[model samples]
Structure formats: C-alpha cells, structure tokens
Target chain A: MSDEVVTPLSHEECWQMLREEEFGRLAFRLVDEVHITPVNYAVDHDTLLFRTAAGNKLLSVAMGAEVAFEIDRYDDHHARSVVVRGGARILHEDEEHRADNVPLRPWVGTPKYNVVEITPRVVTGRAFRLTRPWLHLTLDGLGQE
Target chain B: MSDEVVTPLSHEECWQMLREEEFGRLAFRLVDEVHITPVNYAVDHDTLLFRTAAGNKLLSVAMGAEVAFEIDRYDDHHARSVVVRGGARILHEDEEHRADNVPLRPWVGTPKYNVVEITPRVVTGRAFRLTRPWLHLTLDGLGQE
Candidate 1:
C-alpha cells in the first residue's frame, strides 16, 4: 500500500471545485477578532461573488481587510478542501448589475442588497484519504465465512 | 403559514449541536490575514479540542489569537449553522493526557503530536428554512388525480 495519505491539489482542480460548490465558509477579520460565517457564493471568472446584508461582513470589506473562503466535501473514506485568501470589496452601481447575471441568491428570505466580490490572492487545497479506525470487520469478507 | 423563516438557537441547543458534530472549519488570524481550515474536533466540557501538527494553526494558538470555529448542516429544505468564538491555546505536558480521553483523532495517517483547546467566549447559532426555487411541482401533491 502507498504510504502517501495526503496530496496537494492543482490550481485548476481548486477552481473547478469552487465552481461546482455553491456553499462555503467565509473568514474575515473584524478589528482584532476573526469571524467565520457560512455563505452561498458563485464563481465569476476568477473571482467569487456573494450577497450579504449590511453588517460586519460589509463593514470588513469597507475596511479593506483580507478574507479567507473555504469549501470542502468528505465521504467516509476521502476528503478535499480548498481555501482562497484575498481582499473583499462590495460591488456598487454597474457592478451590482454584473453580479445579477450570476445565479447567486440569498438562502434565506431576508433582503440582502449588498453584493460583494472576493479577488483571491492565494488559492491552495489538499486532498487526503481518511483513516477509519472504527470500521467493523465482517466474517463474510473472509474466506472462513 | 407563518412568515418567520429564520430563528436563533438557544445556548443549550448550540452546545448540543457542537457536541454532536466532529468536523468543522477553524478560522484564525496570522498577521493581518484571516485563514480558515477544516478540522476534526471533539467537545470537551465547555471547550473544544483537536490535534494538529506544527504549522500555522499551532502558531496562531501560540500567539494567543482569537479563533472562530463553525459547523453547519443543510438539506434541501433547512439549514443550521453554529459559530463559536474563542481563544485557542496549545496543550502542553500533562494537558495532552486530557485530550487523549476524548475521541479526537487525526484523519490522516500522519502523526499529530500537539493538542489544542479552544475556550469559547461567545457561542451562537441559527436555524433557517431554505428557499428552494428549483423544486419541481407535482400534480400528486395537489390531489388532482
């Protein structure tokens, strides 16, 4: 058996994963504290687009703080995660119209009028095989059964 | 039907959800940038515990940075998210023994010697109904047949 359990994902694979998944967690700095919130996002070209209400997320973008967005999926045997670190900014006027072209929508019924974009500076990901120590052994799988 | 679609989770409920889940994203600051990474964790009393190799996550704990950890689950109809904000620190010497009592384990085959604890200052959560615009209507539901 191969001893390698973790492998690095390529840039193309990272973007493909981002494009396929609509939900992810967004991490941003608000003053000295770091906050992570789940968000629904869409991949637009090389940037990520999402809508938000007027709150700390918008405030953080206004303050020009760096943000990290992550998405992952795991089954019983394997897992993959992609992280994007970048500067977030709120879209305005014509940019808001551009955002409308994407399929992004608020998950809740609340009105989230502010559209934000994340321009990634660093994108990295990893795929790893999980070790299931609790897997049950079955006699049927053996020749004795 | 009532128009209320989003509801806040009680403190007890938040803790219950945290206790039930073993995987979540941990967000912390390194310098001015915020980073998010998925981790497998276990709830130990009022704190959260997980093991990691020597890396940026451990470095953030050593620097006494406030971290945000989040876990969420969503289906086609509903979604629930819980966020925990706390200060993370590395467990040393005998403290590592306490972590061993928990079910926490590294997902990969590599060895993770350092155990870290997150002492939460604020824990909050919300449950919301999802608006699935893509749901197809069936005549059977209307009793047309």
Candidate 2:
C-alpha cells in the first residue's frame, strides 16, 4: 500500500547537504568489532572535523583507522541520506592551530585536546519519496482517491 | 559556542531505546570502501529486520558482511544515540516466511525481494545535553540567565 521513487543524488548535492547538517554518525572497527559513534562536527574545505577526548573514537583514530560518516533526514513522505568513507588522522600541532581558527567545536562541554580529520574518499547519497499505505487508505476513505 | 555533558547509557537503557526508534543508518564495507545507507527497519526479538532489492546492501549481506547500525535523536538541548555492531545475513527461504510474520516493512515502498537480518554482537549508546552559548546570550539579554 506504499509506493515511492528512489533517486540517486549528485556529488555536489550530497556535499552540500553534508555541510548543512551539524551531526553525523561515525563508524569504525576497533578490536575486531565495528562501532558507530554520533558526533557533532564541522566541515572545512573537503575534510570533516570533530573533537575527541579520551575514548574508543580517539583510540581508533590514533591507530590510523578507516571510517564511515553518515547523516540523514526523513519524514513521513521523504528521506535523504549521505555517506562518506575515508581514513581519519589526528591533526598535527600546526594543523590543529589552523583548525582552531576554523571554529570547529564539539558539543560536549569537556575540552577535547585532539582534532581529528576524515578526508572522504567516496561520497554517495540517495533520496526517495514514500507514500504511506495508511495515508492512502485514509485518503481513499475521504473520496480523494 | 556549545557546552554539553555526555553521559554513557547502560546496556538495558540502550536496548530499550533501540526498540523505540523506527529508522537507522546501516554501515558496511563494500569493495573495500565503507558505505552507509539509511534504512527503515523493525526489531524482532533483538534482531534488526529490513528489506533491500538488488543493491549493494543486499550484496553485502549475501557475503556475510559485518555491519554497524545506528539510530539517534537530537534537539537543541539533548541528544541520544545507539549503535549496533553485528553481522548481516540474508534469511533462508524458511526464515523469510517467518520474518514476514514480523511487523517488518520497508519505507521506500519498493518491492524488496530479500529480507536481511542483523544479529547484533554489541550494542552501546550515549546521551548528552547541550546548552547553546548563543541561546545563553539571548537569555542574558532578556535578564533570564
């Protein structure tokens, strides 16, 4: 009772949407297990920037890990998603100073001493429209069908 | 200007919250690149159920791929996130029939020939509260802060 069309978004559209969102989920592998963390980040140029204190996320980056970052939005009728896959590296002292100038800040109140950057190698996005079956039924009852 | 306190959620609390959400982002590695897709899914006895047609997600599960599924909710003041690390597998014909009994449905309204199940090996979550520095400034101007 639901019908919708799924469409692939362009590269520019995906990047633009990514820049517009403030939060995303970062996925990585640690200790032979995959882990995902939701983080507040800012985009600078082509790199994604976020702060981290001492935690699994920091540990994974310290080991030079490959990660996936994703952000999405959905409503009853529409949905959009963007995914970025890349390697994460802790910024050097000089780079951190430059990043500090970029106004990158973490939502957590605690001070995050390290700045990590994910240089996305592949970015893809999908957009789709959905028609709820129940909604359709309701409309049919109202003689709108 | 964001200041927030992040609290680690307990296992029970995380699971409870996971069952409450209807949609999540699924992360997996395909062709050596990590990719994530937003999927509408349902929970069945601690397992995540979702549908996919002929796509990378279906192909990945057919290969017995490890995946990470994440769901989250956020507002101006608080955010909660849950991540499930698991292996994804396509249901066998018999299992497929059983899954049809579950309340699992796709949001895209497309005909998904394959039903996939993700058996989570580890689940974790975090909750945080943020006080926007800008909001504080506005409140201060009104003599409320």
Candidate 3:
C-alpha cells in the first residue's frame, strides 16, 4: 500500500474551514524571534477579524508586520490544517465601526479594545490520514502468534 | 460576576499539558516573515522533539532561529494554551541516535530524516473560561418578553 496519505485542500475548501472554526493560533515576528498565541477569530468577507488587548500582538500589527494564522482539527482517523499568511492592520476610526458587526468576542474578561484584521496574501492547507504506531505494533504481534 | 476568567498556569502544569498532547503548531521566522505549521511532537526530558523533511522548518533550525511552539485544548466551558519559546537545533550524529528513542513518527508517508529539538528558554501558559455570546444573547432575549 502506498504510504502517502496527505491531500492538498483547494482554495474554496480552505475558506470553508476558516469559516467553520472560531479559534486559531496567530504567529507574528517580534524583532528577531517569532511568537504564536491562540486567538478567537471571525471570518468576514475573505478577511479574518480578532480582538486583542494592547499587548505585543497589537504592537506587531502597529508595526505592519506580516503574520500567519492557522487552524486545524483532528480525530483518530484524519487531520486537517489551514494556514493564512497576510499583513495585519489595526482598525481605526470608521473601520472600527465596520468591525463592530463581525460578531467577534474575546474569551477573557479583560478589555480587548483593539480589533485587528488580517488580509491574507496566501492561503494553503493539507489533510492527512493518521497512523497509530503503537496500535499497529500490537496488531502485528497478535497476527504473528 | 466578573468577566475576567483567564487564569495563569503554573510551570509544572504547562509541562504536564505538553506531555499529554501529541500535536502542536511550530512557528518560526523565515527571512522577514513568520510561518506556522502543525507538527506531531514528543516531550523528551525538558525539551521537545519532532521529525521533519529538508524544508523551511529544517532550514530555519540550521539558521539558528528562535522558534515558538504552542498547543491548546478547549471545550464549551474552558480553554487552555501553552507556548514554548526557544532556539531549535537539528540533532546530528550521536544526537540523532538519541532521538531515535523519542517515538515520534510522521503523520504523512514521506521520508522525514531530519530530527529537530527545541530547547525552550521560556514556557508560559494560560487557562480561560469560554463565553458563548450567542447563547447568552438568546437567553437574554427570551427573558425580555
């Protein structure tokens, strides 16, 4: 049997997955290092919107750094992942009013007044079938006896 | 009731979560931009180990770039996240032999001959209670009648 179980996801499928999931990890460059944090987001008109407090995440967007956002789901049989690479910008003045309708909510009680939008430059994803090595070993041993 | 529901996880709790989860996202800098990809990993000693092919991830390790690895879990009521920030190095020669005992296998069928280890400089995490805004709004509307 061929061992290659990975399948590439199409553009439409990628956007659909992004719409279905509300939580994801946001990765951004901070000087010489990279940082990743989990954020709850909403997909709106081909863009991703998330709210954050005034922190390093907000600082990175203020600096206009390119960021990557990813979401994935997996079970015992299969796994899928989607990644969006884009430029992040904080909403300002009139734009902030537009974001008010996106239905985004922060999980914590802390005030997250900063609403950031990620305009994706490239979106990519893959799906792969999972293999349980220890389970396979046990089955193989049983068959050998 | 206070809206703030996030609680900081102890260092011990962070490592415990890391040991329990098999998959996480690895974020690293590639030139001017940052990238994040899902990976299956193993917790060996105080470090994290994963296998990868000769790709951007391996190249980043060769460049001695600092990276971030994150794993999280959430349910209807709560969410927990852990992030590890540190330098990644590709295990070589004798070190590769040591990594052979880590029990990490690739989800894909492709050959992944390179083994990389992340020695973390800082490990931080948080646990937060989730709020379902739509559900709460629906209940509030029902009571308004």
Candidate 4:
C-alpha cells in the first residue's frame, strides 16, 4: 500500500548477513529433478558447511551437483536476502578433522557423518524497506482542486 | 546435543503449512546455473502464484523452465520443510484479469505486471523435532556402569 525501496547490498554486506544466519536452504538436482532443502549450517570463511546423512541430499553431493544456497530474514516492513551458488563437495577424509572443529550442528539427532561444503562461485544479495510519502493530502481536497 | 525425532508430514499437512507461510524461495536454472531467490507469494489451491517484472526471474519463467519453490519454518529444536517442484508459466493476457483476485503481492514497490504460476507436479515435506533418551545418565556414572 505504501512506497518501498529495494537496495542491492554490497559484497561485504552479503557475506556479513550470511555469516549471521545459521540456517538456509540448499537447492540441487536429484533424480532428474530440482530439490531444495532447509539445512542448518556454519559459515567457514567464504564457503558453507552442513551435515547430512545417507539421503537424497548426500547422494546429490556425491554426484558433484551444482547447488544454490539461500538465507534471508523478513518482517512486515523490511526484507533481506542472500543467495550463494556454487559446486558442492563432501569433505575428504583428511579434511574431516578440520570439519569437526567447525561447530556445524544438525537440528535432528540424525548422525550426519557426511560433511558437505559449498564454495560460492557467485554471491549476491538485496534489501527492501518501506518508505512513506512526504506530503499527505486529503482525498476531498484533491478532488475539489 | 540430545536425541531427536524426524517425522514425515502428510500431504494435507504440507498444504496447510504452505498456506500459512507467506514467504518462500524460488529455485530455477539460468544459463546452466542453479539460482534461488526469496519471493513473497500466495498459494492458489494446488499451485503457486507470484508476480515479477522484466527480469531474470521473469525470463526464466518465459522460457518454460522447471522450478522448485521451497517454504519452511525452523526453530532451535524443530524444523519443518516443504519442497514443490513444478513447471512455471506466465499467465496469458486473457487470464491477467483473474490474477488481480490473487492475494500475491510483491514486497518492493516494483510494478510486477507479469503474473507467473507454478502448477506443482510433486509436493513433499518433512519435519524434525528434538527428543530425549529414556535413560539419561551423568558423564561420570555412565563410565562407572
């Protein structure tokens, strides 16, 4: 009903927001179809790390699937969104030791031994806020004029 | 940190959650790349309706792209996620008038004259909650036993 402004967030702002959010949606292809799943993750510098067990998600990662990860916060008056797109890979046996220190946790008690990471090839974000008009005129006054 | 349970919501339950949530993420492939964007949308019975102007979002829909729309709610102890994979199509000129009746509204003040619809071909959802083990034991007592 009111006017609004949509601003493109800077690269630094995008990363900042991504780091703050602990949960996001991961999208990848599975069984010749596109699937998106919400994942609890940790930000490891520029890449994202999440744990998943033997499921469609893990299978996709094994297939070298390109993925898109998105996280955002929204309220009645404002919304901020960030999207990270890149290839996802499972951490190798040697890299698993470092992942143990990353603090990634799964909501369910499902033992997520498979640690997957998405190295962002492209990152972008945008923010939207509502604004009000400076002058408020009565509908009756406008009609008379 | 504790035991948890993962429950599979039925089809009816999934639809109910979809209707209650007003915001979601839309995933589509563009230029051999997977891209996901947060969108404010309204559920139209078994389908999804959202408006977008002349942008990549609209272009992807115009090209008859298969898209994935995801909406979820999560907390520290629980998470519910629903994924809808379907084919997207722009509403025809003759059908534009009916689009006005839809509750879909864009957050920004952008003139989203293009009304796109995704008729879901597959809809699935799952929920996870925390649970505690029946025999909770102290760290020292467990080893002694």
Candidate 5:
C-alpha cells in the first residue's frame, strides 16, 4: 500500500453521480438468501423505484420481506464508486396514485405488475486512483499544505 | 419489424459468448440473507470457479447450496445472457493454492482466496436483439443443426 495515493470525492459529488446513473443492480434478501438483477431505475426524491415480476427474486423478497437496494457509479479515471444502501418494500397501497405506475421507459406489454420503493438508510462512498512514480511525487508535494 | 434484418444468436452461441467473457456477477443467498458481487472468472474443466472471503456468498454455499450464477452482456444493439441455476460449494479447503492466487489485473486484488465452485442444475440461457420497431423476440431460433 506504500507509494500509492488515493483522492477522495465528497458525499454530494458521489450522490450526484449516482442520481445521474440510469441503471443499477437490485440486491435483495429472503430467509438468508441473496439475489440480484439489473434493471432500469427511476432516481428522484432521495429514493428508488423498481418494477419486477413475481418471479424468484420477488418471491424470495416476500419470505423475510426486509431488503436493501443499492445504486452505484464508477468514474473511469478516478475509479470511484458511490453506493447507496437502503430498505425497500412494496409501494404503498394506493391505486389512485399514478406516481408508481409511470414507466420511465416504455418497452412493451404491461409495465411492471409489481413496483417497490427503497428509502436509503446509509450512503457511504469511496474513490480510488493510481499514483505513478511521477504522479505520486506531485501529489505528495500538494499534500504538504 | 423488418429493418436492418440482424438475426438473434442461438442459446448455444449465447453460452459460448458467456464462457468467453472474463467477468460475471455472482448472486448468492446470504446465510442469513443474500449478496451479489461482480467477479472475474475463468472456466475450469466445465464448471464455475471464483474466489471470495468468508462473506455471505460463501456462507450460503457451505456444502450443497442451491444458487444462481449468471453472465450477461448487452449494448444498445443487442443483449444476451446465460444463467446457471444449480448447486454450489467451496472447491478447496480454507487455505488457497499458490497457483490460483494470480490477481485479476495488476491493480485488481487476487483472484484466489477460496475458490467457490458452482455445479448448475439447469443452465437456462437466451439472447435478445433490439433494432427498433421489432418485437423483443427470445432467441428461439437456436437453429443449430
């Protein structure tokens, strides 16, 4: 680990990057079982919304019903990732509210018969970078301040 | 439905493409929950072998654990995936063999801690292509002779 330097990005910057990302893999848990799937997501109001079928992923979610949803993005040069973890559950039972029904991108057929929402619990993130010999010297000099 | 006329790759072809891929994600049921991680892997003797710590992924695969390991690749032009649904367990003892300890890349950490081997029960796979206005057809044309 010696001779390597890493720059850190702030929470706000990481959150902004995550919000700008359009797709993410959903992580779920049921009776000690873990599963993940990639899907298009709508990110707004400090939460996430996902649409899935009543398949194994959803069926498993119903077993214990407590779940965590994560969203992240990595910058190429910086090699940084912003990950937001949260608790999720089926959307509130309100057929009158059309907010959950709006599909971010319409494909075909009925858009997601099941919709779930996740409210973030903890949002911790990190950034990694390479420090070549020359780069390391420059960074060390700058850190003296 | 008839535009550029690109054809869908067969399921067999999808499997081959998946094997050619060096990176895939492992979704495991956490002993008390579920966890998933993107892993770099190599096909060894026609089975799955990836390294991990004593995390949820391995705890869930103590001896004879049913799990799902999947490989997927897609772009705006096409999307294809190969999913392995089956049993998984540790391939070696707690100590890692020196030969398998090579790193994923110079920067990425080691690929050998304890190799997890997944023996699939049903390896279901499919491929899809989106060329605009055409229906999202499953790769039913596994037109293999």
Candidate 6:
C-alpha cells in the first residue's frame, strides 16, 4: 500500500471500510423527496440492522413503499462508499438487537425504543480521492505500491 | 394536557423533550442521491448546530443547499417527532460548542473537525400511537390517523 495521494481505494477496500464501521446512514427516497437517518448498526454478512424509536426515522423510511441504505466514510480528500439498494420492511418489534443493549443516545428523553432490520440484495460501492475539483480520479491501482 | 389514551404533546412540550437530546440526524441530497450523518449537536434557539469531519455533507448542504434534520421520541406505542427542513451552512469555527470541555465519542475520531449549523425554515411534527398498521395520529398528523 503506497502513500500515493492520487490513488483510489479499491471496491473491496470500500466494502471493507463500510463493514468496519459500526454505524452508518440509512437513505430512502419517496416521490420527490429523500431521507437519511443515522443509525448504530452492525453489518451481518450482507444485511444492515439498527434500532430506532419507531416513528419518524423508521416509519418515514417505510416511505409507504421501499427504501435504500447508504453507509460511507471519508477523510479530507478521500471518500469510499457502499450502498444497499433494497426494499426495507420494518422488523418485528424489538426482539433483534435485544433493544436493551443498543448503544444509542436518547434524543427525545425517552428510555426505550424499537429496531429495524434491512436485508440488502444489491450491494455496490465507489472510491476516489480529489486533489481539489480540478483533479479527481479513482485509484484503479488497487493501492499496490 | 389530557392524559387520554391518545393525548398529543404540544410544540412546547416537544421542543422541551428535544432539548434534552444532544444528537440528531442530518439528511441531504447530492446528485439526486440522499445522504445522512449523525452528529452531536446543540440546540440554538430554533437551529441545529454540530460538528463534521468535512466531506460531501459539507460540500452538498453547506454550499447553500437544502437539508433536513430529524429528532423524535417513542415509547411502546406512542411517538412524536420534530423535523427541520432548511439550509445548512458552516458556522464560525470558534462557536461555543467547540469547547474542549465537551466529551464526545465521534466516529471521525479526530480534532480537525469543522462546525456546522442547520437553520430550519420549516419545522413540522406529528404524534401517534401505532399498533401494527393502524396509526392513531394527533396534531400535525400526516399519516393514517
């Protein structure tokens, strides 16, 4: 792995970075709108799971239909992402994540909450570093020195 | 302030509940795609202020773009929300919340972070007691009531 400033992180590197993250953002679209929510999640193979209070964040993503989850990480000029394109159906009430062990901070002074589990079938990612807008490229070298 | 089975909390009550929260989700759109991040924030009057490690979030939303921030509280069957849809811009780097006195467990895990402030032009909310698909809503309701 070289310290080259112009190299892009590989597809596998992108997925690895995303998986290394214990938390991620949940993205969803509805009509002309899209919503993203922050969640404490664990990547179980190819699925994404997080706990929410059940109303806005969880139900809003329901979107009266399907939704998407996007988890990404970036440092200054380098960004790598992995997206899970799949329809999300709210999980059965708080059995998974055990509800009691979720490391979530209460944003509404509430003591308890529910959980949502998403199984993603289509997982894809992209990685690149920008030396400002005038110079941007994908590190196709796979970070090999 | 009726303790009826479906009593709705007023805006004041909701804001008070939200004030106790120091974390929230910031959602935005870039290239027709939605992205979200969780931040530890402080409520300044009506706006949401937090810090970021700098990336697409700052690029997309802070460059005079629209975004959304949501916070909610939920119990076994009752929930309430407060969402702000407006513009997010970079706040002064020396804001009060930047104090070293604050303790935060940030995923970015670095001190080179920047402060972001989200000023919501539209603040909307609704409360409900949901049992399965049947949603019992209160004031500002937008779903099945």
Top candidate (TM-score)? 1
Error of 3 at B55 (Å): 4.9
Regions of model 1 farther than 4 Å from truth: A1-3, A55-63, A135-145, B1-3, B55-63, B134-145
lDDT of 6 by residue, B1-145 (tens): 3344344556676566555655456666665455554455666676666666656444544346777776654444555656667787775656745433333223333446666667767666656443422123222222111
lDDT of 5 by residue, A43-104 (tens): 55676665555453554355334443434332222344444555666654583144344333
Q: Which one wins by TM-score: 3 or 6? A: 3
Query: Which whole-number lDDT from 0 to 100 does residue B134 have in model 3?
Result: 51
CA RMSD per model (angstroms)? 7.1, 7.0, 6.9, 10.2, 10.7, 14.2
Per residue, candidate 2 scores C-alpha lDDT tens digits across A1-145 of: 1333888889999998776776788877664455667877778899998877846444554347678888887766777888898888877778887566554556667754677888988889888886545443222221100
Candidate 5 lDDT score at position B8: 44
Q: Could you give the CAPRI-style class of model 6?
A: incorrect
Query: Residues B1-145, candidate 5, lDDT per residue (tens digit)?
Result: 2332233456567556545654565665645544445554555545666655545444545447666666655554455556665677776575345215432221134233556677666666544443322223323221111
Tell me the spans in candidate 5 whose CA falls farther than 4 Å from its real position.
A1-14, A30-34, A53-64, A68-85, A93-103, A106-112, A123-145, B1-11, B53-64, B93-107, B110-112, B126-145
Per-residue lDDT over B70-128 for candidate 1, one digit per residue giving the tens place of the 0 to 100 score:
99878667788999998899887788887777767787878656778999999999888
Residue pairs in steric clash, candidate 2? A109-B4
DockQ of each: 0.39, 0.33, 0.39, 0.26, 0.12, 0.07
DockQ measured for candidate 6: 0.07
Q: Give the TM-score of candidate 5.
A: 0.62
Candidate models: Cα lDDT each: 0.79, 0.71, 0.79, 0.71, 0.50, 0.53
Better of 1 and 5 by lDDT: 1
Candidate 4 chain A minimal-lDDT segment of 10 residues: A136-145
Better of 2 and 3 by lDDT: 3
Per-residue lDDT of model 6, residues A1-145, tens digit only: 3454334456576556555654455666554455554455655555555656657554644633545565554444555556665556656654554433433333233344565667665666654342322122222211111
